[model samples]
Structures are given as structure tokens and as C-alpha cells.
Target: MSTGTIITGLRHRFRQLNEKPLRDDLIFYFAIIAVASVLFMALPLLTGEAAETDGMHRAWFIVAGTLIVLVQGLITGAVALLAVSLVEHFFLLFVDVHREFEKTMKSAVYALAPLILFSRAVLLGVSFAGLLLLAWFCLSTYFGVWIFHEKSKDRAVFVALATDAILAFYLHRWTVGPWLAL
Candidate 1:
């Protein structure tokens, strides 16, 4: 009940979540987002909705598009990190001490099932409009992390921004060209 005890508990939980497998998973998810972001960048370009169309114009669009992709990479990275933090807190309630971190990670993966579907729904219905963003920010920040981990204040924000950037990049490239068959 002391502030120091709470901080210690939070730190322990954070370390547990950042173990080897969990970190690997986090990295993998960010890579997926990075690829997806490139696709997203190509969308407006292929459709000819990009700000510039002519030779000089195209050059401008390319520069702007690249910037967007980079931002996307940062955002998705943040999402992966946020997911890990949320997983940690949610798992804490269901398991014993030793299992807490792993359970949290698994639970976070499960949580993404709904978030992905929901985000798709939002995108299909409205694209990347402000309203959908407002909704995502509200949900991912307040209900997602804060409710579960009382100490999740900083984690939710930093992770969300990073993941959003990564996802944006993934989407940008996929929109632009032929998919690399893997």
C-alpha cells in the first residue's frame, strides 16, 4: 500500500514480461507491421490520390510517402510493446507467481484477436479518419492498460505510439507494389 511497494511490484511485472520469448514475439509482430505499412503507403499512390502526380509532383509525393511509412514503423513498434505490458497485467490476476509473466503474454496475444478484427472494421468503415483514431486512442490507452495495471501509465502511451508507426509503414508499402511472395 505504500508507493514504494507498488513501484517495486510494477517493476517486477515489467521484467517478467520482457523475457526472451516475449521479446522475440514483440519483435516479430513489429516486423509484420513494417511490411504491412509499406502496403498501406502504396494505397493512395496507386489510386492517384497522392498529393503529387506529375514528375516533379511525384517526387514530392514519394518523399511524403516515405515519411509516412517511417512514422508507421514507429507506431507499430509501440503497439507491440504496449501489448506486452497489457498482457503482463492481465495475466497477473489469473495465475500463480511463477506463471504470471507467461500467462500475461499469452493473454495479450489472445487480446489481439479482437483488436485486429475491430481495427479492420474501423478501417473498412471509415479509413484512417480522426473519429476512429479517437476511439482507438481511448480504448487502447484507458481501458486496455490502465484498468489492468495500475502502473501502466507510461507503458500504454509509449507502446501505442511506437506500434502505430510500425503498422503505418506496413500498410503503406503493401498499398504501393507487387507483394513479395514469400
Candidate 2:
């Protein structure tokens, strides 16, 4: 199919998901973020960072990590809204959803505006590593959705998550392990 068809289909799926309250979306986003958070926490341990040894520090770490994941979840929620809008507009050709492509794209760009905050955070901060990972993962997930709009969402998400896992594992072993002497 053409690129236009793919975009339209994604927009349709997005609208379908968004026909509910924000809370439902939040729940889904948070669950994904929490799983990702656990993975993030585990990474430090794999490198012998001792996050598990200090109970007090680990408690504080979890609190801070949870807040960061929550924020990342909020960002994903916003991106979902935009993707839904775009899918509706683009795919409306197949199953029209009362909106123009230009209008939808404009709205999507605005909806994705907050993602820039994440880039800024990555550039300026020395802390909140787990949050950074969550932000990057969310961004990657959305981009994967857009790129693989022709596939079932299950396949697309699986493709994206698998790619990320492999890349992260390799990078951890090749780059981080040597630095940390693990």
C-alpha cells in the first residue's frame, strides 16, 4: 500500500483507542512504563552498581524512579492522542473520520511538542537515568507505531520492543560493561 494509506490506517486505530477517557490510556501507558522501569533498575545491578544493597537508597531510588516513569507515561499519553488524530485523518479515505490531513498533521505536531522536553532533559541532566530511558523508550515506541502502520499493532509493538531489547542488551555488554568493569 501507499504511504498515504498507511498513515490513514494508523490515524483510525489511534482514534479508536482514544474514544475513552484519559485514565484508561494512563493505565496502559503506566503499565508499559513500569515494566520498562524495572528493566532500567535491573541494568544498574547487572553492572554491579549496588542499588540493591542499600535499602534506604534503594527506597529513595524507587520513589524518584516512579515519579520519572509517571512523567514519561504522561508524555506517551499525549503522543497517543496525536497518533490517533493523525490516523483518523489519513485513513479516513478507507473509513473517513471527519477531518483533513493537514489539520490532523498540524495537531499531531503540536501534540508531540512535549517530547522535546525529554530531549532537553537528556542533554542537561546528570541524574534520573531511569526516567531518561523511559522517555526514550516511549519515543521509540511511538515512532515504531508510525513507521509500521500497515501491520497489526501487536506485531508492530513486538517488533519495536524486540529491537530495543536486543540493542540495549548489546550496548550494555559492549559499552557499559567495560566502563563499569563488569
In order, the Cα lDDT scores of the candidates are 0.49, 0.48
- Per-model TM values vs. the true structure: 0.43, 0.32
Which candidate leads the pack in TM-score? 1
Candidate 2 lDDT tens digits, 88-172: 3444344323433444343333333343333334333335543445435534444434432344555444544554454356335
Q: Pick the candidate with the highest lDDT.
A: 1
lDDT of 1 at 122: 51
- Report the C-alpha lDDT of model 1 over 9-69, residue by residue, as the tens digit: 7556544544446566555555556555665666667787777568877887787777788
Which residue segments of model 1 deviate by more than 4 Å?
Answer: 1-20, 94-97, 100-103, 106-121, 126-182
For candidate 1, what is the lDDT? 0.49
TM-score, predicted candidate 2 vs. hidden true structure: 0.32
Q: Which stretches of candidate 2 lie over 4 Å from their true place?
A: 47-182
Check candidate 2 and list the clashing pairs: 8-90, 8-91, 10-87, 11-87, 11-88, 12-87, 12-88, 14-84, 92-96
